[model samples]
Target: MNWETLIDEESLALLLPAEYSHFALPIKESLAVFLSRLPQSVQDRLVEEQLALPVDATLSERLGRLAHSCPVLQKLGQILARDQRIAQELRSELAKLESMPSTVPLHSIESILMQELGPLESKSIELLPPAIAEASVAVIIPFREKNKPQQPEGVFKILKPGIVQRLQLELDILTEVGSHLDSRLHDLGIPPLDYQDTFNQVRDKLRCELRLDEEQLHLARAARFFADQIDIAIPELFEHCTPRVTAMERLFGEKVTDHNFTLTTEKQNLAELVARAMIVQPILCKDEQALFHCDPHAGNLFSTNDGRLGILDWSLAGFLGAREREALVQVMLAAICLRPEKIATTLLSLDIRGQCDQALLKECVAIWLRRMREGHMPGLSWLTGLLDEAVKTARLSLSSDLLMFRKSLLTLLGVLSEIGANGFDLDQIVMCEFLRITVMEWPGRWLSSPNSRSFATRLSNLDIAETVLSSPLIAGRYWQAMWQDSIERYAVCANSR
Candidate 1:
């Protein structure tokens, strides 16, 4: 884990693409400068041996080593692993990092657990030797209660002994590196960005993962959120739980990425189930605060034997306030209906900090609409692309929660692709969810008093007005798109015949 050893020019050459090798020098210099400011003892601890990189490692292998070196980097790797834009070889290697080998010793884990929750014997908990699973910041050790032999096995998620310190050091290093890069934006030919602010936001979210109490709260909320949905399963919490140790019913299932699991189930059904559980439900839920599972990587998701999607790891979660969710819904509706003006207005409302160019925003929305008309599916990618363009072109500053939600959506898309869910029509799924929400929630929304009407309710009213006003045009566009699709299919059929 020594910064000097793994982040040197030679290692960077192997880890980075040949075209981007020039970035190595600046990166190395930044780390060197940052390390110099730290005390010698601190630096030594930071470089403590964890996982060693192979000397003759391939590009993907080297990347994996770097990711495993730090919790922050491990998370980045998980997100990138699902990204189809990355090289398949590299993605495959990164995917392996999701189920990291247990690096912390059993005795250390035992000591921490004893300190936090007393002796395992006293609590009737039989600690299983050797951790069952390991992730970026914690390890899952399966245990059984002596008194409840008939009950399902439970898991204890123990934080790594020095993870708090290690994570803090890593965040500091990142801040320093980000500051260095931001200062060199002109020389590096990179576009303008609030690198320091972005890193700060990321740091805050990562710190949230360290608080197991908050994670427990998140788990409880998510359980209630999906209580009525039989197809989705959330881990049930046990009586003995603490900030350092979480005891929950062990989820029994195979990773969604397992080929054998996919072979046994209908791919489309499984894919739809995942989409509903991860993306659609969070976006369209009636909750006053929208709760989203920020990390949906392959390892964190499971396909259970009872045909339910088991979601694990609630440490990293995101919430969108009522107004934010309303704005987001409005933007989505505008994009789907091809209303550029509405898209522009909705986006503008979200940019509270900066002055956005109204003209530029509309132009970007129009371009996005053109792509949609050309048969581009309006899923996470299409929506994010539009938002990214708006952020860059109009200098719009969106909320951190919305940005986190976007990142989650992208990760979900990557998971979908990994599980062979890419073949499912995302647009159709989105449309179905939208219609279902409108129908099921409309009555309650209408009955609410005007004084008590939430932002979401007001937005729902606006959405109804806009839809009614533009129904003819929206119907025409859909009809034309359908007609074009039918014609294309007919031509293919004729040619085949």
Candidate 2:
């Protein structure tokens, strides 16, 4: 249906805030640096987009629209199967089920679903089931819809237990979430990606508490969505994701995140290694920017016998950009260095609230920054205090990614603190290592050193040069024209209006 073209026009109104676009000081040169790498086709597409979009939009607004309007995400697995290996393995497993007795239960479950959800919105149970309940196994069952019997996803899967019932309930809710978000965005005339964090949280809670296989399966898919793809489809797919019930079977591996068992000096290195790996992860996995591994938690990450890190649980992920990732590292680095103002600035830059008590925010920033700076995980005083304040004051909803970022950070820090990371300095050699890597690919100019007066001076010069160059060619023509002075202009324009 050439959905990309269909959506591009309407998406601008939501993405470009009216207040931001009308600013005379355009950020073109900065944008040009980014645009140079794009293909001619994409550039042409973007040019049309930029022309239609308001000139004074914020970077976030512009980037947000671009993210959701892109088409590739909508058509995942359509071109060639990116995960052919995983798909093939799944198919083989299903085949093996046909020859085993375990196939009976899955067949029963599929039968249970077909009668419930209808033929559409369901994966085909055409494949057989698993023979044994391996530690972590995912099962797909088919069914009919309670309302409409004819949808594509009536079929579903499980990652834990309580599959069939929970998903039906949750799917409807997510659909509503998507619908309401869709309506609000449509009103703004912007084609935007709906936030999936809450929806995925519900999905994760359902999986972890219920221990359903399909829930975990969906989580894995969510992870895959963030980890490997940057298409708009991730949100849409997640919006319509049907879990019904999922069980995430425990996979066997050397447990990661194990902080306590008074380790021998020999094993201390392994513990340190796992701990170090946690920090290095965001740095090492730049190539997979396409995916968002939202949960790099100890429980979710494991080390194999061969020392390869195994990351599981991908149920919630968004297509995060490089700038966001870089900002994260920088914020942490600043925290370690006890740079309170820098940390406050970075946090606010992440869109905490456009205008709040800057001093208060700095105080809060300093508190947390101090903890991370000292490599200590502070108590709930640092976290719940703000969260409690925001909730009490108003329903302050920040980016859910920011929420996840906080959760992961807290979890990591809390673990390190509990385990006695005596010399685990946040501003240690690792900071320099990450700093070099970050500088190597810092996406935005915002990350440069604060004390670099020379760079600042050059930027000031460039701004002046660009402003002079961009002087309107419309020059004295429009400048000299009186407002509605021409009789023909007034009469003709009035008539058209």
Candidate 3:
């Protein structure tokens, strides 16, 4: 490998998109940085831009980064957001607001406070998960390697539960005294569409809407690597529970949008496996709850040389408590089995709608049901479009809390069909899994883990998650702590980069 060549277009067409052609820079640069410590040939190919434009980094590498950052960030924010002395000091000043006339611009204090706050990021790379004793994963060690980990590029973190009551108190005042904040719009006056742009495009739109430049979007996305740090920057309100942060672990793998080998099926199989692992792991956890790693963008999805699927970024993960998971199981079963009304009924059980919109929800469910039954298998684009539109048009203000479940279902099925890799259909598989789970639950359904072993019995005697409907605090403090860490992870990873 030398400076003369990059991954040729023919091989690249299998993975890279034209729109993402521009993203080649960061990906390439990151790879170069990672490869620089490796053998001269690897260095020549990556650093000298001699390897093909898109080569692959494996999955474990990505996850290792994700897992490491998530915890580190949480640790950082726990120290900062929950610093009672700082809060006590800051809160002491709010009384002064009593002296100002009602018209005084107080929120300007936001800028002043932001200036005073400072945080840090993690150093070096988190290369892989601890070795599992049950299953062995083959590692494709590069010919030359660095003794220390290379940091992820372009990430940042935010404060957790800082000014908890005060911020909300201010937001309430701002909401009541609100002179309409600008509706989200680009200079083109074109509002952003949730479904239209893929991940990267969405970030660009975000930069514009938020008045940031290309560098900022890079910073934000790169922050995905330091997910562990999110909680450190932001603190949760309840001292009993920790806050959450979502972060990304950028993919370090060869992109394969097309199949060139006879074993092409491996790609889809691995992808579906990745998707399944994501769903299964949550249930495996004691709480049956974990952040749904939402972004599965190209840079986010990787097939390292060895072929394990890694999911990155738990930043926007959707968390499901015991009841929520149960409700979700019910809904997923209903959707796959083509029972639209049943799904709607389950949503109603979750109190997804107000009394007035019950009929509309049912009607919408009917529409979705009909599409599932009569139409071709659900397509990702169409489904994403509908999901986005429903939220946008939602007058009743349904929280997008369950969105990741919807996405997990869609993305699992989608990547399979797109690559023609496997017969993986989320609705189909989830339905099957539920039928088994439901049977298993018939007797053990109410059973809880040891930490919360008695919870099911208590819940059986009482309504829990549903009753706490509007709470942003789902899955309690343990999860909140995990979430907070996610943000810190991104922040640290970004700074390290």
Find the candidate with the highest lDDT and give its number: 1
TM-score of 1: 0.84
How would you order the candidates by lDDT, starting with the best?
1, 2, 3
Q: Output the lDDT of residue 387, model 1.
A: 88
* Predicted model with the maximum TM-score: 1
lDDT of 2 by residue, 22-54 (tens): 211222321233244345676678657756868
Better of 1 and 2 by TM-score: 1
Error of 2 at 331 (Å): 4.5
Please provide TM-scores, in order, for all candidate models, with all chains considered together.
0.84, 0.38, 0.38
Question: After aligning candidate 2 to the native by TM-score, how far in Å is the CA of 478 from where it should be?
Answer: 54
Candidate 3 lDDT over residue span 309-368, tens digit each: 534322334555666666544454445445556666666665444532566666666566
* Stretches > 4 Å off in candidate 2: 1-164, 167-254, 257-266, 276-278, 283-292, 296-299, 329-343, 352-359, 365-397, 412-432, 435-497
Q: lDDT for each of the candidates? A: 0.77, 0.40, 0.35
Candidate 3 ranges with C-alpha deviation above 4 Å: 1-252, 256-261, 279-288, 313-316, 332-345, 349-356, 368-396, 404-414, 422-424, 435-497
What value does the lDDT take at residue 400 in candidate 3? Answer: 46
Order of models, best TM-score first = 1, 2, 3
Per-residue lDDT of candidate 1, residues 42-71 (tens digit) = 656555532344456664675566567657
